[model samples]
Target: MDCRRLGEAGPVVSRVAFGNSLTAGNQLADDSAVACVRAALEAGITTFDTADVYSDGRAEEVLGAALSTVPRDRVVICTKVGRGAGGGAGGLAPERIRSCLDASLKRLGTDYLDLYQAHLYDDATPLEETMRGFAEAVAAGKVRAVGVSEWAADELAEGARLAREMGVPLVSNQPQYNMLWRVIEREVIPACEPLGIGQVVWSPLAGGVLSGKYRPGAALPEGSRAVAAKGGDNSLRRWKFLQDDTLERVQRLRPLAAEAGLTLPQLALAWTLHHPTVTSAVIGASSPAQIAGNLKALDVALEPDLLVAVDEVLADSVVRDPDLTLSRMLRRPRQA
Candidate 1:
């Protein structure tokens, strides 16, 4: 439950953020979802992250209900925009940004968001327009800070410039980062560090691949993410870490975890937080125990030698290409 500043000028939040992606979309029962949120709060997790597009906005409703009993100032609620309502269309257009923020606030039963992020970079909408929209949100007291997720290094630099011009504190960049996924380290971190933007990293455990629950040659665990993928949840499939080759490398890390008195998930999460640029690691869970276990990483800090050992073991298995930072949307041209 250690606290860290969201960025150079943002509010301090818990080192580990409770994520609602799983709790949304009927992925977990409503009671279980509520219990998980309650557990996180009991454990002193002050930050909760969700997106409007998650479970078609059902996730925000669940999170809102869970947080209703807590004092609003005691928590930092972070949600996103630009994924669009359903799949129709979404961008950083001022209108869409304003609409999404209002809808998210209504669903979350909150008057203001501690942090409102763009789910991804909108190549279609001018960055200046998006910054102005966020600026307006801040001026109106609807949002305290602005952030973006999965944006490339160049895009982040440009966004930071516009945000400064608009008098908005662009505080965070939510990107995928973990022991096995190091793409953000090369360029994104460097770009953000100077801008005073910290990272709120997602998928810190690589969709449970770093949990060592998925054996390399054995059958997928009965209730693992791989099993969920087989049941038509293709979200985890995009990460190549699920492949046998990567799983084998993960298996090799078990010895290291044992030596450090850490679970695979803790080891993975700790590695992500080791970076100074990382403000928080977002973790999703289906049960209270899962949330409790992941929170242990906040107390476990790896030594310098152990950190090096991790890289040595994961050498060549890590995904480090800067080009990989681009989302599928960023890779393609906006249709006319």
Candidate 2:
């Protein structure tokens, strides 16, 4: 697989980072999750992303166990902290940040994280306080670089300015970006471009909707995320990615993928990497083969005309309003 520097100040990472958010102890069995992580390593993926709240923190345990077999220096481990750190304390308050960082370190079985991100901005905490907490982690050698996820364009600029003042290397921002989801392009990308912060995008395949597996007229596939995630945060009904119009538009891209000598999922994954500001596309997998299949995206280069064609096909089906990029966590009360 290809590699890219995460940002001007961050470590170089694989073009495709493995995301343990969904599969770790949630979608896949322990042994199976371990095997999938090992498969990512075998496929040359060196960056692994997880979060403390994923699967109630079991994701970190599963990912840590999988990475223990390899030399620590060989991989770039990235994880986020923001939600509650347990015991009812959460948000990006200085104390909460410190406590969550320590707990994440313990769960991941690592002394320091290569990339430590605020999973979501804390509306209740002062931005300086949050950046100060991350700055302290860097000073204490508990984290290599600081980053944020799902922050708005203005939030990123303000945070980046604060981090610079605090001597913190604010590097990357994690956001949901895919062929059909263009919310970040309107403001977030332009805001981060000059600041030297690159994007580590999630849901590149739009939660598998871009993979062309969800047919317009067919019943929801058995055991699919849409089926398994029913009535929850990831439920298909909540996200509306399974709508027939969207699926039909996604299906139109099949021939384009064929022409590019790639699978539908490969086309979806490759489309995300086409952006120069994208550091890596995070791929979450339920099996080893899934990781292996996505690795091919690093090699499939989409022509400019093909990209335009994609835009034309998905036209109105795309979601580009920057207002939609705000974090749902903004509604949560302040953490004590």
Candidate 3:
């Protein structure tokens, strides 16, 4: 696997990060999750990303166990805090940051995290306090670098400023980036490029919608993210790609994938990594084969003409409004 630096100052990590957000709950069994992590390690993906709120910390335990046998220095472990489960308290309050960091370290069975991120921008807490909390973690050797998730361009810039003042490197920003979700392109990319903060993107396949398995008019596949969202009010809004119009556009990309000699999912991943600002694309898998298949995306080269064609094909379905990032962040309550 090819490696890339998180930013001008952060640690170098694999281009593809193995995401463990789905390790627990009904998504994946403990043993299966361990096997998938092993598969990723064997395939040369050295970066593993998890969060404290995922499955209420069970995901971190599973990931820590999976990497226990591997040498500590051989892999980069990344995780996040600030978000709470079950609508409980959640924010980047200093005390919460410290407490969550300690909890994550215990759960991961590690002394320090390579990258520790605020799961979201906390409107409730002062950014300076959050930066100080992260700086304290760095000073005490509990975290290597700090980052944020789903932060708007302005929020990120201010955090970067505060992080610099605290002498802590704000190295990464985790966001949802994919063929259908291009919200980051208009502003986030431009803002982070100058700050030396790299993007670690999630949902590169748009929650599996870009995998070409969800046909325009066919029944949703069992266990798919789409299927799981069947009755939620946010299902349609969250998964606009499930609509026939969008799925038809997605289907049109199959020929493009074939031209590149790649699977649809592989094509989707390659598209995200094509951008210069992207440091890594976090991929989650329920099986070993899924891990292996996604790793192949690194080998596929997207031509300029092919990319242009892709934009033309999905132009109507793509979400480009930059405000969506901030609006989504605002929708979540801030506490803790």
Candidate 4:
């Protein structure tokens, strides 16, 4: 497995991390979840991402079992707090953060988490308290490093200040970043750049919308997130990225992936890693083969002109603008 550093003096994990969302079971049979983990380990995907809020904690349970198949030190385990594994944003009180990390450790059946991330930015929870809680976890040897997710520039900066004050190392920021969701580049990416914080972008596949299965007007495929009853409302903030223009771009990229001997998903993931700001790209797979396909995307660089060609397709479309309007698009923190 190819390893990437989560900033300086922090954990180095597999570039292709195993990501499990609430619906991992949708893609894998009950037995395959564990099987996928084992397969990922054998395939050298040493970084594993799970969250307390995924499937009300069932995802974590499944992930823990899979990691248990391998010795602990050989693999890097990453899980998140702040959002209840049940899927609601939980206030990050000191006690809540501590309790959540402890519970995640217990559920994952590990003594310490290699990377413990805040699932979301809990505005209601003071940034100081949350950073201190994660720092304390590191100090207590219960966590190897601290990280955050879905945070904007200021929020990431705040965490950095607090981590420095508390003498804790804040290592990374994981966000939803893909060719289709480049919004982080405008806000989140610039913030973390100077700090030397690694960026592990989740949803590099845009919730599977970038996998070339969806079309302009075709019926949704089986197991696609868009087909889920609740997928639309939860992801409405990102609906534009899945529009006709995005699909057209994905179609155009078929030749690119074919040229690289990869699939559309591989092409998309490779395109994401081309960014200098990204440290690693988190990939969620329902099956072992999906993870296997994604692993090959590492180091796949999209040339500048090909990237420009992809953007030309997006220029006129109403699809996602990648800026989330925070820096280039409209802001919606109030909606959350």
Give one digit per residue, the lDDT tens place, for model 3 in 1-336.
Answer: 899889989989999999866554437778888888889989999999999988888889999998998888898999998876322444777788898999999999999999999887776777788899999999999999988998899999999998888899899999989999999999999999999999999889877888988888888788765554323224334647688989899999999999899989999999999998899999977679988887788987799999999999998799998878942646656688
lDDT string for model 4 (42-138, tens) is: 7888888988877767778888877776788888889888764333334576788888888888888999998888877765667777787877788
Name the better of 2 and 4 by lDDT. Answer: 2
What lDDT is reached at residue 106 by model 4?
86
Instruction: Name every residue pair that clashes in candidate 4.
Output: 52-85, 53-84, 53-85, 183-322, 325-329, 325-330
Cα lDDT tens digits, model 1, 1-336, are 789888899879999999977555556877888999999999899999999988789899999999999999999999999865333344778899888889999999999999999988776777788899999999999999999999998999999998898899899999999988888888899999999999999989988888988777778777665564232236555667767888898999999988999989889998898888888999988679998887788888799889889888888888888777745435565689
lDDT of 2 by residue, 87-204 (tens): 2334788888888889889888899999999988787778888898999999999999988999999899999999989999999999999998888998999999999999999989
- Backbone clashes in model 2, listed as residue pairs: none
Best by lDDT: 2
Stretches > 4 Å off in candidate 1: 84-90, 229-233, 333-336
The TM-score measured for candidate 4 stands at 0.89
Where in model 4 is the C-alpha error above 4 Å?
25-27, 85-90, 228-237, 316-336
What C-alpha lDDT does candidate 3 achieve relative to the native structure? Answer: 0.85
What 10-residue stretch in candidate 3 is worst by lDDT?
A: 228-237
Clashes of 1: 0
RMSD after Cα superposition, model 2: 3.0
Worst lDDT window (10 residues) for model 1? Answer: 228-237
Between candidates 1 and 2, name the one with more favorable lDDT. Answer: 2
Quote the positional error of residue 245 for candidate 2 in Å.
0.6
